[model samples]
Each structure stands twice: as structure tokens, then as C-alpha cells.
Target: MPEKLLFGKYELGKLLGCGAFAKVYHAREINSGKSVAIKVINKSNICNKDGIPDKKIEREVSIMRQLQHPYIVKLHEVLATKTKIYFIMEYVKGGELFNLIANKSRFSEDLSRKCFQQLISAVNYCHLRGVYHRDLKPENILIDENGDIKVSDFGLSATTDQIQSFDGLLHTVCGTPAYVAPEILTIKGYDGAKTDIWSCGIILYIMIAGYFPFYDQNLMLMYKKIYKGEFRCPKWMSPDVKRILSRLLDVNPGTRITIDEIIRDPWFRKGLKFIKFSGEEENKDSLISNSFNAFDLISFSSGLDISGLLKSNNPMDDLERMVVEESPERLIERIEELGKKENFRLRKKKDWGIEMKVQNGKVTMRLDVYRLTEHLVIMEVQKNDGDGDLYKDVWRNKLKPIILGQQIPKIEDSDS
Candidate 1:
């Protein structure tokens, strides 16, 4: 027998996540059987004393309803009752992209390129529809089970309606300090599109450098550095990366790299996965009326163990999967090559898995390869036993680029 339904239309499952103001639960659509993540937020945080939804929440819902992109999270509908509001969104099994980066400290060039490409594609689409994501930090970005980007958190977004008629710019000063554009600090006015591009540059830098490009203990000092475009690129970054980042992080918004320029750049165009939009037209009349407002979407946070923005997967939910377009044999062969080059002993296990050992077997690693289709394979990497410099050398230097080229990241989240 099925569990009792919530709202009489959805069957709720395990608690995916929760925070001070909201809880996210896995659920199934009763009629359509579609999987979704339902975020339940307390009405107190999103409504006034009179019980009307906050204007910011309403604007977020309005903006999100208009955005339909593959790389962005899909908000199916909004529901509410006396005490709480429910947000039915696409179910994303994997948590934030911030998790893997936190574990690795940095990403290989290939992986960085893949993430940046997806971000740019989504942001470009948003700008085309006159929407701007004021906050583009790691907390607002998510990854799905398929290892694809799912941009989330539109609470700080703005549309054409918010632009000032007198100056044709946005006067609001909002967003995470580290990612906010330099011009936003002036209090004069700034182009929303340009500020969004600036945030993108900061994100790309963090992916490659494992740190913020502009940061300081003093907020004013940090703002000064950002205003002056004072940042040092890591020496190990490739020439192409450094070159593009220079243009992207330019302090002068007037000269910053535009979306078209980024699309045409050789580095961004490499192995780019061009995701198509749904049948939803860019300028189609909004299908929604004001019948539904929005819940407080900022109650959830980022990090594998993160909580805050509405409801996300549990910080403890550790299942991660990636689909690769390669034969299981080919994938195994590549991993074997990496093991051999790193002077590690490898043994076959169960005809489809490999166990690797280094430093006299003190550090061990295992990979289980499964063929999902004739041409698609999924590999799971598990760590076992101790850790040492030899382990880092094998994993970071020799194995990463070869095994995870433009693939969804493989973060070591288990205790094994």
C-alpha cells in the first residue's frame, strides 16, 4: 500500500534535507509518477503579519517560472496551506558542485572547462530573456546524478521590470561579497548583465584556483581589490586559462568579456556540450497568474553537509553517479594505463572492477565499472586504507585528467 499523500497529489518519501525554515523531501507525483523534491517552508519566514507572501519571494517565483533551460533547476509548481508552502522542483540526487571542489582543493583543467561552459550557457540564456541572476555563488549551483549542472537559487534574481527607467541600470547592491561585481559597490548604478558576467569570472577562478580571486578580512579592503582588478593567477594555470580569466575579471565592466565573446573563445568552445532549450519560447506570455506567490527560497545553504536556500539533498546524502560515453573496456584500459604509469599494482576484480595499491599496499583504491548501455559506462571509485603522498600523487597527478576528462567529478565522500 502507498503511504498517505501530501496535498492529496504527492506521495512523500525520505527527508532529503532540512534547515531552520524549511525541509526538503523526496516525492513522487501521484498522477504522472514523476520524481521531484518538495521543499516545505514555514509561512512565518515568507509572509507578512497579514499572511501575504513577501514581494521578493513573489518576484523569484515570477522570474523562475519564466526561465526554462536544461542547465537550470525546473520549478514544477508551488503549493501552500495555512502554515507552510511547498515547492515542487526537479529532483537532483547529487548535491552542490561546491562539494567536489572542496574535497579536491582544485579541479583539472578539463573539469573546470566543463563546469564553466554549463554556467555560461545558462547565464547567457537568462540574459537573453532579460533576467539576471544577482547571486551566482557556489551555494546557488547544483549537480545532478547524471553529473550535469543544475543552477539553482533564484531568490536574488531580477528582470527587466526592476531596471531603473532613468538610468537603465540596477541600483540594488546584493550578492555574496566575494562574487559581487566591482561596480555594485559604487552605489551609483550598474548593468545587471555585466555584474552577472563578473560573478561568472569569479566562479571560474575559484574552480581552477580553489580560492577566491578577491578576498580580504576587511570587507572594504576586498572591495578595493575588486575595484582595482588586483588579483594574481596561479602559475600552474595554462596560458589559455590565464588569458581568458584576465579578460573575464577585468575591473572595467565596459571592457569585460561579453557572452558572445566567451562562446567564441577557443577554450570555452572546446568539447562544449550545447544544451537545447525546451519548447518554451523566450518571450512567451507567462502561463501563471498571481494565484500563487513563493516561499522563502534562501533557507537552504551549500556544501555536501550544507543547509539553507529552501530544501536541498541532505548534506549526508553521499550517492554520486556519472554517465560517460565510453565502453567499459576502454574506461578500464585507461585506468590501467594510469595505474601502470604511477607505479601502482593493479588487480582485476570480478571481471569488471579493479583494485589498486601503492606505497607497499598502505594506500588502496578500488573502482567498480558497470556498463549501463553498449556505449555508456559508469565507474565508481572507492578509497580504502591509509593515505600518503604516494596516494595524492597517484590520484591527483596521474589519474585525474586521464580518467575524469570533462566527466562529472569523482569526490571521495565515503569513510572507507
Candidate 2:
């Protein structure tokens, strides 16, 4: 009747909420005795004239699976019937931040400070792992039974790797209207992490004043005030709080205070403490045992095969202007000999590594040097970080002559 029994495990209960294209339900996992929130979407609901495709929902599921953080809402599994898709997620017992705000009218500075600290920690973890929650807001931030904030709704979340540039900026406008950053309205590329932080500032302001910072029923005037950084603190607000809010609400994404700095600020760190990074005593139930481990996790595969990331047609060829490192003259000479004899150019070199832009086109050859063991040289045809991969893919498919080789490439530049 309701298609498959929700991935053949969980049994759906009453409806929690419904939208234009989807519905959320309270469900229980038979195997683990765990309660969960199940979201179901009809494929046809998003398939009409001007709706997003079902594939985007699939992509959201893929992204959620990769994230394993305590502050983030976890996705247990994805189940699908012939015509519908279901996402099984952890159930948060507490209510929305908006409800709490409405009841309290406003939070004391001390309370807002505690909540902001927890928020910064969660957001910083996401940034380190290259995931940006583009839709951060008071409603999206849920408070658990212990009052610890849990950021939910990854439908708008995206990996930094999926984005072309950190600084090239994101122009897509998403998130709640009141909390939307100025850059979103401009349709210009903006840093995803920075944009999230801006919304956090707005949340902080609302928590203190019980009112929206920039208010207008008209979206255009609201955006104008946001772009101009036009907002004022209530008369009763302290100078220190006002000062911090000003910095956080700065329109220039680049100059905004990073999450790291926010946590270190006196206002946030004062009057609160955690035991052994195990979360506060009051929030013990909100924290998972192994939550701290994700903060410093790194994966290493010494035998990573990057040959496929390197094959391209527009290879680096010009050698005249190719600069070689003087400190590492031996390594430079070796690579120069290879580049010139092979009729290839090594441009845009850096410390801790080097990138060889092939002549005649944008195809690149790079060598990442590791000094830990024996000055190991790793070769990659495709860009391994940020926009490097996109350039690699473009060079490979859109070039005239195919570029191939195992040249060491010059390290004449710096990594920064």
C-alpha cells in the first residue's frame, strides 16, 4: 500500500510535516529499537515544469552519507520504491529554535554566548572537511532535549570539492530570507563558509534582541540594508556585544571572522567550559562518545594512483620562461632536463610542491614532493585540489594534442 516497507526495515508512524514535493514522518527502526525521522519524496512532485530533478535529491543523500559528525543530523539509509524515495534520519526529540525564541522573547548574553560557541565548533568541523551548510538559520538549527544545537537539513549542503573555487565565489541564492547574506542577493560568487557565518551573526542578534536585524517585507530593501551592513543593536545591549556583532555581520566575506577566531573570542569562551572535550555536563546526552576524533582525522594512502588524473592533450610545452628553484638546484636540473628534452614547459611552481602547466594549452603536469620518507614524487595529470581537478578534466577532453609524461616539474613557487 505504502510501497516497500521503508527500506524493508522501519515502520512509518504519523506525518510530521508535508511540503510541495515531500513529506516527513516519525518512524521507528525495528532492528535497533531506534526512532528516526523519515522523509519521503515523490519523483513526479519535483518533475513538473519548473522544479528540480530527482537526481538532486539523490546527490543530497550521497553528500550526507560522507558526513559523520555529532552536531550534524545523521542519515541512516536511503530507501526507494518504484515511484518514491525515502531518507531515514536520526530523530531529534527537541523542538525548533524559533519556538524557543518565541517563548523566551530573547536570550541573555550568557545564553547566546554558550549557543554561539557550540555553533562555531560544529561549523568549523564542517569547514575543515570541506562541507558548507549553505542554509544555516534559526529554524534550521534545532535544539535537543539538553539544549545543545543540532544543525539539520543538508538538502542545500555542498562539498567544497564540488565547488570550483573558495574565492571564485558562489552565486546561488539559498537559505531563509531573513537570515540570507548580502552576497546571495548580488548573484556573485561568495565563500560558502563565510556566508554561513554571516547568518550565524544574524541569529546571534535575534537571540539577543528578539527581532530581525534587517527588516522589510520587501526583499529588495531588506537586501539593501544587508549589503550596506545596516543594523543597530538595541539600547540595552552592551558595547562588547555590539562590537562583536558588527564584525560578524561585515558584508565582505573575506574579512569576516572565521569560526576558529570566534571560538577564541573572550565573549564566547567566558563563563563556559567543557570537560575533556566531551561536551559540557549539561549537554552530555547531546554528544556522541567519539565526536572529538573527527576534529583531527586524516587519511593517507602512500600508493595512491593518480595516473588517470594526469592524462591530457594540452600539455605544458614551453620551457624558456620556466623558472627553476635555486635552493633545490639538483631537483630543478633533473626536471629541466626532462622538460626541455621532452619539449614540455613547467610553469607555476610552488614550495611543498610544483604545478607544471603544459605549453600550448591549459593541461597541467604536477609533482607533489614529500620529504617525510625519501623526497617522494607523486605525479598527477588531473588537479588534486580545488579547481585543479576541473582544469585537468577540461584539458583532457578539450585539447588538440594529448599530453603525457612523467616529468618531475619545477618547484619554483610556494604552496600558498
Candidate 3:
């Protein structure tokens, strides 16, 4: 194929890589003299040999277009031609975190903390946005010239509002075998956020040791160890470091140390020498730990531009009509009724706002409301079954679009 202009602007420089469905290129922005990466997928790839339509790649691109965050790779622009689709993204020059570790053996203590801080900030941002980045690994983490990291590849991510557990058990077998959470392997229901945390713990271990905690030619054995959270910290590791790692690698998601707590821990603090690179303010005590409060967690979303989703046509558009005349509980009950009719079971109450259980009378699917604006409501759902198809189908087929668009209802409006 001859070289072609993407989105009528990006000039393709050279082919970077090829996957089953798309080709990536290193490209240059014609106007600002900036560089970028462009991925082009052929529409033909969306169809099977029999020409059956496959909308998966298109859906992935649509979802990518809606997300904007610093820690997450930015999808700058997308253009679809009759035969192909193009994704223009900010190019991170430093390559994968995996390559960095392979070359350096292991990171210094201070460097690990800095990297962990960035990772947690990214994960927290996704959680608040009601998105879960289900696939997180060293290879998927891209670094830039300034040593900052960007979490890439949301191909496996999904909106939590719609996903539910499968057969009362978790279902999706997707994710890198090594970094996957123990609960995921058992085919038991698990939170997407919690799964990310498990990967984060594994990454931390790799950053410090330059090797995976569980590795073998046999994949099954590796999975077995992951479920048990069984691994030995090298004797050379500091006691403080070992203590923090143990908490993050906990097999039970419920007790797994949270990101907020990890960032607040002292072990992570010891790695912040570079934060004061100017050599003038190194004396200030570095705050370090993994634990963080919900309030502090929101800070990570500072760089995210959630306006796309907030502005999109959604079902909650009739907020004013729904809010002014009815109590908040009424709205909750209405939504609950709708859910039950669709086979989802309600948990009767909620912590932050409201909660619901979706299952086949055995497994649990999670739906938790985080906040509600007069015009908008934020929610997170956890589905283990990968049967997220049911909810997505409902949105595309049942829920009326444009119900809500671009307006966040104030807390005062939704609060009791």
C-alpha cells in the first residue's frame, strides 16, 4: 500500500509494528512539528472470513477517544476512512517499562517509589471515571523522555456500570498470566480495580528485583503461586520494603493494601530522592506509604479530561425533571426496580450512595454508585464473567440515548 495521510494531517514516517488487526507507525504532526504514533486498523479486520461484522475494534477506538488522562496514553485524534480507521496518539519516546528493567536489572529504592506513585495516581483516576484498565503490565506501561509513565492499551477495560459477575463466579480469562490476580485465576468474581492492584504489586516486585516473583516454563505452576500470593522476598530486601510488599500481594482482595495506604507508607518514601533533584530541598521529609484516603485518591484524576463522557448523550438527561420533584431515594428505588426486572438483585442499601448485586443466584456482580450530579451520576461495576455483553447490549439496544449530556448535578441536589 502506498503511504497515505492520516486524519488528513499526520504524515506517516515509518512502519513501527504490526498486529493481527492493525499496523502502527511513527508519524509526524504536519503543523506543530511534533511527533506521534499512529495506529491504523483495516475495516476488513472487523469482519470474519464469512464477512460477519465485528465491531470490537471500533468499540475499542470509541472508548479510547472518550478517555483523556496524563498517566494513561492520550488518544489525540481518530479518523475513519471507508476502508480503515486511524488512531493518532502522543508518542512516548522511552519505550516499555519492561525494556527498562531488563537493561537496568533493578531500580533503586527511590526510583521505585516515584514510579509507584505515578501508577496509583493513574489507577485512582480510572476508578473515579468509572473505567477499569483490566490489562496492566510492564510491557503495556510506556515511558517518555522525561521518565514519566503512561498506562496504555485499554482494549480490555470496561465501564463498571454494566459488567456483572458470571454464574456467581468471575469469568474473563484475559490478562497476562504472570501479573493476573489470584481471584481471577480461580474463576471467582473479582473487582477490576482489585485485579489492577494485584498487577501493581507484581510490578513493584519486578522493579525491585528485576525478576518476576513467580516464573516458570510451566504456566499452571505460575498461576498456582499467584493465587496463594506465595513468593519469597530476597533476604537482601529491606524489612520495610518486605512489609509493604506483603500487604499489596495479599491474596484476599478485601484486605489487600490499598493504593492510598501504599503511597502513605514509609517504605515508598525512601525512594523519593529525585523529587528534590534541584539539590536544594532534599531536607524536607519525604512522605511515603501505599495507603491513601478517598479524598487524596481523587487527586490523581487532576489531569484527566472526562468531558467526553460527561458531554455524551446519555440516559440521565432528564435529571431536572427527576430531581426537583422526587426524593433521592425515589430515584434509587426506580433504578433498582429496573435492575431487578433485568435479573439483577439489589443489596438493599449502599455505603457511598447505593449498591446492587447482579448474579445467577450464586456469584456476585458489583454495582456501586459513587456520586450523583443533578445531571449526572458516577458508578462503578465489577463483573467477573466477561458477560459484559449483556449490559453493553442494553445500552445500545434499550436505554434511550441523550438522556444526560455534559452537566454535573451538584452534590446538594443528590444528597439526602
Candidate 4:
């Protein structure tokens, strides 16, 4: 690695990790002598050849900007050059919660409850600020040296504005498979807060069980079990904990327990003191001012057009097209299997393809499938009454996994 100073301030150190779009590095501020993790995303990777921005990156940055909580990772500053966008963020010394579970297979109930309390507190704080963390899993939850939980990764998060525009509902099906809510797999519009609660319940279960509540080698079967809410708690769990889990993992969002209810529950509240949010009036103004300052700095320094990143525009522009190596007949069969598992109504058209429609309340979506060639298939999805971009996200997060029959292709390898 190059031992050069970045932007004439941050002194680069060791490699942290690399994802499809960015590489994280352990760096230190030369002037302040403070350690921070810098996320360096390639401009070309995230933007189209014509310079159109990626909505996922834009949403992640925007949500992090507005969030200021002890449990959420802090985004200190954003800097950009012609080739890269740099995110200077807090460096949590401890690793992911997944690592902790690997070391100690399962945690005791008291310890699990403590961690769950922190997770719930952080998620509740985000919900209070109108930000919804759609993806909550062990890998995304980081631990600090102090052993406290810090929620990270907002790539799949949605803001309240986006959710409410769709009639107070979100149709985006994005999250880790084992932790995804039943509604998301069903492709039905869902309440973000309630879905997050479901994930928390799964995390709580994993903390005690060291395995997924619903697990299967066959993806379709796993989804079927999830939709049916089929998971048995270990016999050692107390009735109180099991009751709480049932409410959190409810198949119906309407009856799922809310964060407020979870906090108030006697079982969940044991050995935990809720921290009250005080002095909101001043903090709100400060948050707004800081957001503007950050935006101006990025715009002025980068000298790149960021209008698309700052605003919501055409959803069609976000559609993803993939050509997989599979026979058309086999692909169609798999798609049908997945649809049935998720409880979607399928309409097949001979010589053409298939269309699947799913509805919840006033929200509806149509997924269009077409065979471009004998070995290649194309899928396009759109919400009937809301932003089509949300549908695109759902296809990538939820449906794509089933269609690909594996983990979704990474951004770097998808095109090739």
C-alpha cells in the first residue's frame, strides 16, 4: 500500500477491507492525531459512464448525515476528488457482532438482552429521526472496544419521506435473506419500523441460539418457512422471552410489536435503563446547519455535478439488467417456484415470459420477466403507484437472490 497522505491531511495506513464500490482504510488525521476509517468509493464504479449517480450511495450518505447518535457510526466529513469519494468516519476498534458470535457460539440471556437493548435503542433513535435501517444483521452491527453496539451500513435504508410518498408504506425488498421480514419476501408494501423490529428479533434469537431461526439449504423452502413464521425457540428460553419473540417475528406487520412496546415490555426492560432524548429544539437546528455545511463542502471541493445525488429523479434510470448463464426454461421454473413461496400471483404468457403481482393495502407492484435469449433472461419491476426506483431496489435485494440462485453479484463482477 502507498504510504502517502490523502488530500494533504489524512495519513493512510493499513488496508481495512474492500467492497465492490469502495475500499476502506485505517487512517489518521495528521493534524488532530485522531484515528478514523476512510471509505474510498470510486466515482466511475458508483456513477454511470455518463456520470449519473447511484441512488444507493446517495441514500446512504444522506441518511448518515442526518443521524447523530451514540450507537450509530458517526460520519465526520466527506471529501471528494475526480476519481473517488472519501467518507471520513468514526473508527470502531472492535469488529462486527458476527465475529463475537463466532468466538462464543451463543450468549447467555442476560448478555443477549443487554446487547438487544442497545440495538433497539439505536434503531429506535433512527426511527425517531425518520430514517429506517432496512438492513439489520450481525455483519452490519459493529462492536466498539467498550463492547457497545454501533449500527452501521445504511445502503438499504429508506427515509420517512420515501416511505410516506408510497401511502405510508415501503415496497423495497432489501436485506440479508435470513433476517428479512415476511412482508419483504412476499413483495408486499411494508412498514419500515415494523420490519426492522422483526430483524431485531432475529438478531436476539441468533444471540441465544447461534443459528438462524429459519434455515434451509433450499432458498425457496427457507422463504416458505419465513412467510409461515415457522421457527421453534430452544426449550431453554423462558416464556417471557418466547412471547416477545413471537410478537417481533409476527408474519403480519399490523400486529407486530413496535419499538415503543418493546421498550415498555417488562421482560425487555429488565436490567436496562432507557435513555431519554432531551433538548431536541436546539439539536434539530444544529443538525440542519451541519448538513448544509457538509453538502456545500463536498460540492465545492469535488467540482462534480451532484444534483442527481441530492434529489429524487427518474426511477427508470435505476433499473438493473443482468444476463445470467441459465436456460430460459430452468430460469422460468425457478422464478415460478420463488413466486409461489412468496405468495405472489403469477400470470404466465407463452413465448413471452411471466408477470407476478403482489399487493398489500393500497400498495401494488408488477414484476415483468422476459427471455432475451435462450440462455439469458431480463427482469424489470415497478410499483403501480409509487417510485419505480423502490421496485428496482427490491428486485436487487430480494428477488435477484432467488433468480440468481446464489448471492447477488457484486457491483464489480455483475457487468462482466
Candidate 5:
């Protein structure tokens, strides 16, 4: 009945939403009894008709996998078949932040500030991990059952590794026009993180003012206004809030306030909880003593074709394991090296692998590495104590290189 429970584990409940290439369904994990949102993407539509690069979907998964922040949506697992790809994600009950704002017409300064603080905290965490959410708006932001914020829709996100060029700037022109930063309109390369900050400012403006900072029926006029950073704050707005907005909305990316600076600002620091890191020296000795599991290297190297290694007749079992090539020693070494660069602290070590913690501002992510065999290793990364998903791009762009010793080939598309 009901197609024998999609994936042999998840019981599809109701249709949640659908987009151009995928449909989202509310589902429950039969074994774990956990609720999740399963995004079913038609392989034919994405790869054939729409010509969407497989890597775009892969990158989104990659970025979401490594991000373990309170304000970001979580991707638990991915399953792909001949016809479709399914992403199991945390089911956020509360709906889009835009809906809340629309219903209220505008939020009080205290509420708006709280939402903006959470938004900035999440964005700051992304920046610390070298991830950039190219798209940031009320529509992409969600409110949980507790009324906390959760950022979602990372399909347009770009990591430093993805956007960095010889000049160290991103040239991509992607994202909703209204929420896009001014620098993105120049056609010249721009700093991904800084551009994201600009969008954050716009979201904050809308939350407090109940309207877009720059709006006109003519698209060209709107662009002109955005490029000039021309927007007037309501007279009722406080001077301190206006000052922060002005700095974030600066026309020049160079003049924009950095995330660190934002965190330090008096207005931003108010009511925010700061994350602390230990000063203890990293366990370089433990990393050196451990041997790498080859399976992990092979798995990361295969990229998006992990499903190709599935051999079991049962979808649930196959989804749990992937066999691949590579030595355990090399993979372990590579993960340790990359972990150091990403501020991940080595926690525990074993003969086959190790566990590490990545602390970003107020979030701490726990990563586990296990050697399934001499040539097979598996990695499980998630928040130390939450259902949030870690950023995925970190694994694809940062850790994958350590395994394969090269950059993942880029696919050119008119949209990018």
C-alpha cells in the first residue's frame, strides 16, 4: 500500500510544496520515528530538460552537510535512484519568515532585532566556515515552532573554494534580484561573504519597516537605487540601528562591515550569546599517530555518484553504506589537515579514525570518522547536540580535494 513506503523506510504523508524540478513531501522515518521533509527531484527534469548541472545539486548537498548552526535548515541524508533524488531534511513546522512578517505587517523593534540577531549569527557561522549563502531573504528564512529562525534554500550558496579565483573574488550573478547585493549587479567579481552581508541588511530593513528598502515598478529604477545605496530609514528607527544598516548597506563592498566587526558592534552585541573556544594546543600528535581509512577517501572522491556503489537489494541498507577505493592512512591524514584549516579541534582518536569538533561562533559541530575497511571509511558529521545539518560544501570543496588531490571539475551553465 502507498507504494510500499517510499525508500522502504520513509512513509510519505502529504505534499508540502513543489518547485520547477522537485517536489517536497512530509515524511516519517519508520525506524527512527522521526519526521522529515523529503525533497524529491526528478532526475530527468534536472539533468535533461532543465539542464541543471548535477554539481549544483551536489554542491547544495555538500554545503548543507557541513553547516550545523541553530538558524540553518538541516539535511539528514540523500537518496538517489534511476529516476529521482530524495533529500531527507529536518521538518520545520513553523513556516516561512515572510509569512509571519506579512501577517503582522511589521515586527516590533525587539522582535525584529531578535530575528536579525539570529540571522546574523547564522550568517556569521557560515562565513567562519568559508561558506556564503548567496541568497538571504525573509522567504528563505523560516520560523520554527519555538519562533526561532532557520535559514534554508542553499541551492544558490557558494563557498570560498567554489567562488575563489586567481583574484580571490566571485563572478557569479545568481540570486533573487530584489535581495541581491549591489556589488553583484556590477558584473565584475565581488566578495561572496560581503555581498551576503548586504542582503542581511535588506532583510533587517524589511522586518522593521515592513517594506523593501529599494522598490519601484520599473526594475531599472530599483537597480539604480540599490547601486546608489539610496534608502531612507523610518523616522521612528533608532540612530544606532540606522548606523548599522548604513554600514551594512554600503555601496562599496570594501567599506562594508565585516562579520567580526558586526559581532563587536554595541548594537549587535546586545542580547547575543557569544561562543567560546579553548586555547589548548591542537592534538597534532594524535592525528599523526592515527591511520587513514581508504574507504573514506574513495567515498569523498566519487563525488555525487555515491549511489553507484550501492549493491544491496534493500534501499534502506544501501542508503546506509557505500563502498569505495582509497587507503585509510591517506584519508585520515587529509581530514586532519583540512580540519586544522577549518578550525576543527581533534577530540578523540582511534587506530582507524578520529573525532573532531568544529566551533563556529555559537555553534559546535561533531564529526566522526570510521574505517569500514582498509579501503573503506565512513564519516558522520553533525551538530554536537542538535538536529541541524552541517554545511555540505566544506566536505565537497575542502575535504574532497584532500582525498582526490584536485579540484572538482566545474560545469558551465548560462544561469551561473
Candidate 6:
């Protein structure tokens, strides 16, 4: 009977949408009069739902907090009461992007390319931050009142923390069937970035052609076609469109065109401005100090932010973080040097660091280098297939010292 005033701040109005575990309502912030979307997640129901991992809910909160792209639905804040968790998000006046396609059979190549540019920019931005939107479909995207694309729904997303011990592959078998990558269906470890690239390609095809490139009434048959990477672009599509589509929908993840390549494509680059958003970059100092603690931030905090309401922060569990003065290139060289001395086989990542494997060919450790500033580089080490004590001993006793410019004796199995 009464309009709900959430936390004595937001005045909740009409219901915008509903899912199995949560319902979104249109709300206005009392102070700023800003129209917002409040997603109320029923704690009791979410706890009982099957196939909905608690991890997924937690990952979405953490990932959304890190992203502030114009083309993404911004999660401004997270709050909780005893019964429900509230996600205060930017309210887009326009509805789902899917509805536009449903109404119009297809978009002109020019319009399709424009939307694809914005979409790719958002996803590419996510990839650079070690976030992979495992579930990307039209329904997950929204169009704002200004008619720009906004990527939504990071519930099934995976971050760097979700990466297996040492390998860079993600094993999660998530995503809608039609848009899912072929490698994902193989049940093998798949590169999240490549899989995302494949989804982007599919979305491009649908926008221009008005239907999925790979489609069949039988689910298994459609998947088989996807696995074989069989799809025919409409004859009306431009040659450039056909060529880029082929590359994007390529079955081999190893050969898929990267985001950078897509950005440079003759078809993709047309009229692309590389637009900057309103709040594109967060503060540099705050980013480093609270990288882990900032997720689901109470804005930005040293510890115990609201993302904690969804899940606990364990920055040291699956990952090792360190700040080094050396450049990413020099750091990789040092890692190569140590790999040689330790008799471990090292695989050089295209632009990152090395993955060190042991005698059995199992990856024991993975090191990724990030340039946070001109002089400050962040190196993250993740365990892949080693014991907890072994990982700590190797990193603390041997690797850390060597990385810090102190020469240490080669690691001995006896240390384990």
C-alpha cells in the first residue's frame, strides 16, 4: 500500500523486472533525485536456488565494482539488511537491447557496426582488467535513454582470482547455448578472452543478419555445427563483414582474432572514436591500495566493504601479489632466468610473463606482470597444481627473494 523508502534514502516505485532470485525496482534517490534501479536479492531464496553458485553472486559484485565503463550498467553501491541484499545501479530508461532486435528484423550494416564498436569496447575494457564475462547475450545488454549500449549482467563473470592454480584457462561451463563458444562446450580449459571474442562475433552476426549464424532446432545438432565452426554470412553482407565474421567465429581459440585486432579491423574501425566515458578511470592511488578491499566498496575501504556482504575477501588464497620497480619486460626476463636455474620448463605468454611447469609437465606456477605506473609494476603469482605449503615455500623462501634482486640457491625438493 505504501511506496518503499529503501534505507530511508531511495523511494522505490514500480517493478522493472524479475529473475528467479531477485527483483529490480525503479527507485529515486531522495538527496540527489537520481533515478536508479534497485535490485533486491532475497537472501533466503538465493540461498536455496540450485545451479546458482554463491560464487557467481559474489563475483558479479566484485567485478561490477571494478568496472565503470560508459557502456556498462554502473553498480553505484551495495547495501544489505537482514532479509535482502540491495544493489543500487544506474537506471537506464530504455529497455533491453534484445527488444530492439525483436522489433526490427535487422539493423543496417552501418548501425550494426556502430553498436558492435561500443560493445567490443566495453568487453575489451573488461578483458584488460582480468574480467571475463562468460555469459554475454543480447538480453544481458541494455540501451540507455541516450540510446547508447550498456553491458549488464556480470553474474556469471570470472575474474583473475577464478583462474586455475597456474594455468590461464577457466573451466566454468557457463553461458547461453546459442552464444556459447565451441571451446567452452568441449569441457576443456578455455581462454576466457578468446571465448568472449567468439561471443562478440556472434552478436555482430545477429545484428546484421537478424538471426544466429549457427542455429538448428536440435540443440545437439546446433552445438555440433558450432564445434565445426560452420556458419554462412548473408550474401548481402560486405566482404569486410564476411572476413571479420570468419575470424571471430573461428573454432580454434588459438587462432581467434584478438580485441586489438578487432579494433583495427577495416570494418570495425570505421568511425570508431575510441570514446571516453564520464567516469572512465578511477583514482590510481586508491586502485593499488584497495585493489582487493575495494570490490563492492563502501566507496573504497581498507577492509570490510559491502562486496564482503556477498563474499569474503581472500586476496592471498588463490593469488600472490607484489609490487616491483622493474618493468614488466625486465621482470619476465628475470622469471625466465630463474626458470632456467630451477630446471623448470617455462612457457612465454604472448604479452605477459611465464608459466613454469615441473618434471611431470604440470604447471606449478603462473606469473603475470601489470604496469600500474611508470616505475611500479604489479606481479601476480597463482598456484596451478602444487601443494599449499609447496607454493608458499617456493615463493617465500626462493622466488620472492630472487624476484627482489637477491640471489637465492636453486629450489630443492627437500623444501617441500
lDDT of 1 by residue, 1-416 (tens): 12348878999998876665678889999999988988787778876777555667667765776565668898777776666677788888888878878988998989999989889878987776678999998777888888788898887898866888778899989998999999999978999999999998988999999999999999999988999998998988999999899999988999999988888798988887544323222221221111111221221111211112333323223222456778778888988876776687998764467888876888887776655445666665556555645556656665656666543345686995
Per-residue CA lDDT of candidate 6, range 142-256, in tens? 9998778999989889876677766768997989999999999875689999999999999989989999999999999999999999888888899999999999999999999
The lDDT per prediction is 0.74, 0.64, 0.64, 0.74, 0.71, 0.78
| Error of model 4, residue 277, in angstroms | 6.2
Error of 5 at 163 (Å): 2.7
Weakest ten-residue segment in model 5 by summed lDDT: 282-291
**Model 5, range 215-278, lDDT digits (tens) per residue?**
8889999899889888999987899989999998999899898876776788876776442213
Residue-level lDDT of model 3, residues 1-416, one tens digit each, is: 42666556778888876777778888988898799998877767766877544645544654565455556787776666666667778888998899998899999766776788778767866765556677888988988898988998877776654356334223566788888888887656677777888888889889988899988889988888887778998776788878888998899998998766765677765544422212232223232211223332343241232223222432222111111232345445555665666676656432333344444534334443433334334443443232455545433332212122222223455556
Candidate 1 residue runs with Cα over 4 Å from true position: 1-4, 14-21, 30-34, 277-416
- Native-referenced Cα lDDT, model 6: 0.78
Off by over 4 Å in 3: 49-55, 165-170, 269-416
Pick by lDDT: which candidate is best?
Answer: 6
Candidate 4 backbone clash number:
0
Ten consecutive residues with minimal summed lDDT in candidate 6?
285-294
Between candidates 4 and 5, name the one with more favorable TM-score: 5
Q: After superposition, how far is residue 174 of candidate 1 from its true place, in Å?
A: 0.8
Q: Is candidate 1 or candidate 2 better by lDDT?
A: 1
lDDT of candidate 4 vs native? Answer: 0.74
TM-score against native, each model? 0.64, 0.67, 0.67, 0.67, 0.68, 0.73
- The C-alpha local distance difference test score for the whole of candidate 5 amounts to 0.71
Candidate 2's TM-score: 0.67
Prediction 1 global C-alpha lDDT? 0.74
- Write one digit per residue (lDDT tens) for candidate 4, span 159-275: 865764436688877888889999987655888888899999999999988889998989999999999998999988889989999999999889999877887788987887444
Note each model's CA RMSD in angstroms: 24.1, 10.6, 10.0, 17.9, 14.1, 7.4
lDDT tens string, model 2, 1-416? 25435666888888877766778888888898788988888766755555445545644755666555556677766665556667778788886787789899999988888787767667776675567888888887788778888887777876654554435556667787788788878755678888889988998999999999998999888878888988988997888889889889998877887775676677776865543332323233222222223222211211121111122221222111112222233454455555566565565343433555544544565553322212223222334333455454434442212122333344466765
On TM-score, the candidate that comes out on top is 6
